[model samples]
Target: MEKTPSACAMQWNIELERDLRSKKPGKSIEAILDIGPRLEWWSRESNLHAAEYKIFGLIPGEDKLFANAILLRLADAFKSGDKHMKICIVKIFLSELKQRRQLRGQGRKDEGILSKDKVDSYRELLTRIKIVFDSGNIEERALALVLFGCWAHIAKDSADVRYLILSSLWSMHILEAKASLFAAGCISELADDFAHVFLEMLGGLLVSSETSRTIRLAGGRAFAKMWCPILLADIAHKTGVNLILESSEEEFSLVMLVSLSKIASKWTPLIPRQVELLSSFMTKDRGLSLQVIALKCLRFILTKGMYHFPANSNVTLKLFGVINQLDFPPALHFDALRVLCKILPPNLDTIPCTEILTIFSKFLQIVEFKLQSPVISERVFAIHVLACIFDKLLGILKDRSGIGSIVSSRMLTFTFDRISY
Candidate 1:
C-alpha cells in the first residue's frame, strides 16, 4: 500500500531527529535540506503544525546546523508557501529568539552570543524578508514590516542593520497606513542614533492635517514607547496640543490624549496645559465618547502625578462642572466622579471650607439626581460613587469642623432615605 502523507511526514521527522542526534553538523544540515520541500508541502496542506513542532522540538540545544536549516526553510516558506506558512515561520523565528534571550539571562553566555554563522543566516533571512516586503501584497508587506522591526531589535548593535531599518522608514509613505504603523512602531529601538530624524518624520506625520487618523495614532504610540524627554517635549509643545485644541477629528484628539496619559508621570511641567485640554472635552458640547476618553486620561494624569495637578481654583471648578452636568451619559458621570476622586486629597485639611463645600455640593447633587434615576443600575452606580466619596473624605466628614458637620448631616439624610426605600 502507498504510504499516506502523514506516514511519510512522520518518517521524515524520525530521520531528521536521528541525523540531529548523530552530532554531525554536515549530516544534520543535509537532512534539513532534504526535508525542506516536505515541510513546504505540509505548509501548503495546512498541516504545518506537526512538522514545525517536530523540527523545533529537535533543535532546542542551539545546534548551529539546525539554526541554518531553520533559516533556509524560512526563506523557502516565504518564497513559495501560503500566508499561513510565512506567518508560522516568522513566529518560530521570534520564539527561538526569545528562548535564546532567556538562556542568556540565565548566564548561558555562549548560547546567547550570536556567532558569525548565526548572524550571516539572519542577514540572509532579512534579505529574503525585504524582497517580500518590496514585492508582496499588502498583507505580506505588513507582515514584512513586523519582521523587519523584530530584526531591528535583534540586530540593534550592528550599524549596517540600523541603516537598513532607517532606510525603510523613507518608503513608509508609499505603504498603506497599517503597514506604516508597523514601521512606526519599530522606530523606538533605533532612537539612539536616529532620534532627531525620526522625530521630525513622525512628528510631521502626527500633526499634519492630511495624515490619516491611523498613522497619527501610530506615531503617538511610537513616541510613548520611546520615553525620550525631547520627544515628550515635542509632543507636549506641539503634537499633543495641536491634536487636542486645533484638530476637528475626535479620534486624533483621543490618540494624542492617550499618548499624553502614557507619559504623564514625567510630564509635570505641562500638567496645567494637559488639564486645560482635557477640560475642553469634559464640557457638555463635546461628544460623549471623547468626554469618556478625556476623563480616563485625566484620571491617569491625576493618579500618576497628583502633586503636579495645577493648584488653581479654575481647574478645580472645571472638574466640579464635569460632575454637575447631570445630562451627561452615565459612563461620563462615572468617569468624571472617578477623576474627582483622584484629585481630591485624602486629607482635606489643606482645602478651605468654601472649596470643600463647593465640591461636596456638586457631588451631593450628582448622588441626588442618580438616586432618582428609574434605572436600577444608575441607582447602584450612585451608591457606589457615594461610597467612594465617603471613603475618600471620611476623615474630614468625621471632624468637628463646621464643613464636616454639614456634610455629615446631608450624607446621613441621603443614606437614611435610600435605606427606607
Candidate 2:
C-alpha cells in the first residue's frame, strides 16, 4: 500500500529527529538533502505543515554544513520558485537570521559569523528580494517588508532600504496587519536621525484602532526594544496623555499606559495630571478584566514607576467609589485596594484623616454585610482588606494626635469585631 501523507510526514519527522540525534558525522546533512525531493512533493500538494517543518528544521545551527546548505536552497527557491514558495523560503531565512542574531548577542557560539563572501552573496540576494517586495500582491509585499527587517543589518547603511520601509510604514493602505508589524520590528534598525519620527509613529499606533490588534501588540513589544527611557520620556512628552486616554480600543490604551509607566522613571510633570484621567478608567463602561488592568496600571505607577502619583484625596475617593461598584468578588477588589494603599501612605497628610476613616468605615459595612452570608474565600479576602486598612490607619493615627478620636475607637472596635469571626 502507498504511504499516506500523514504517515509520510510522521516518518519524515522521525528520520529528521534520528539524524539530528545521530553520532555519525554527515548524517544530518544527509537528512537535509533528503528534504529536497520532499519539498517538491509537499509544494505540489500545498502542505503548510511541510512548509513550516522545512523552515523550522534549519533553525538550529548545530551543523553549519546542513544549515548553510538549507539556506542556500532557500535562496535559490526565492529566485526560482513561485510566489508561495518564495514566501515560505523567505520566512525560513528570516527566522534563522533572528535566531542567529539572538544567539550571537548573548555571547554564545553561533553559526560562525558570515564570511565576507557570504555577506556579499546575501547583499546581492537582497536586490532580488526588492523585486518581490515591490510585488503587486500585498501579502507577498508584506512578507518581503518583514524579511527586509529580518536582514536589516545587511542594509543598515542603505538609504534606499530605509526610504522603502519608512514610506511603506507611512502609507495608509500598505499590508495592514503584517507590514505594520514588520515595520515596527525594524524601528531599531532604521537611522537614528529618524528616531523621533519612529517614536511618534509607534506611539500613535500604540493607541490607534486603525492598526490590527496583532500589530498593536507587536508595536508595544517592539517599543521596549527600539527606545530607552530617555527617548521614551521625550516621546511621551510629545504624544500627550489625552491621546492615550481617548483611544478607541480599551485594551490597546491599557497597553500603552503600561508601556509608558515602564519606559521611564523620570516624572514628566504631565504624568501626575494624567492620573486623574487614568482614574476615570475604573469607572468606564468596561469589564472586570479591563478594570483589573486599569488597577494594575495604577499600581505600577505608584509602586514600581518612578513618578509619584499626586496625593489627591479625590483620587482616593474615586477609587473607593470604584471598589463599591465592582461586581467582582472581594479577591479581585484587592487590586483597587492595593492601588489606594500605595497612594495613602501616612505621609499623605494632605488627604483629610476624617475622609479616610469614612472610606474604611464604609468598606467595613460592606464587608460585614457580606460576612453575614459568608463565602470562605470572600471572607478571607475581606479579612485581608480589613487588616491592611487597620494597619495603615493605626500608623497614621499614632502620628497625628487630633486625627484619633472616639470615632476612630469605634472604627477599631468594628474592625476587631469582624476579624474575631
lDDT of 1 by residue, 1-421 (tens): 4332333544565676676445564664455456555544332232223444465453323333443554455565565556775665556445544554466445554432134433457767667776786788867776776666555544445455445445554444545454544544554534554555565676666666676656666666665544456454545445556645767777767777777666554557666766777777766678766777877788777666454464355656766677666566666666666666556655355667787777767777777876777778767777776777666566765665676777878889977886898
lDDT of model 1 at residue 11?
59
Quote the positional error of residue 411 for candidate 1 in Å.
2.9
Model 2: how far residue 129 lies from native, Å: 3.6
Q: RMSD for each model, in Å, please?
A: 9.5, 10.5
**Candidate 1 lDDT:** 0.59
Predicted candidate 2 versus true structure: per-residue lDDT over 1-421, tens digit per residue: 4432323554565566576456687664565556545533432332224444455443322223332343444454455556665565555545555665576556654233232222445656567667776664676677667766666655555666666776666456536345645654554534465455566676666566576666665565555444344555556544645555555666666666665554432454545744665666666476566666667767766664444556676677667766676476665466666676566664345557777667667767756754654467666666666666667767667767666664477677886785688
Cα miss at 103, model 1 (Å)?
A: 16
If scored against the real structure, what TM-score would every candidate get?
0.66, 0.61
User: Clashing pairs in model 1?
Assistant: none
Number of clashing pairs per prediction, in order:
0, 0
lDDT of each: 0.59, 0.57
So what's the TM-score on candidate 2? 0.61
Question: In lDDT terms, how accurate is model 2?
Answer: 0.57
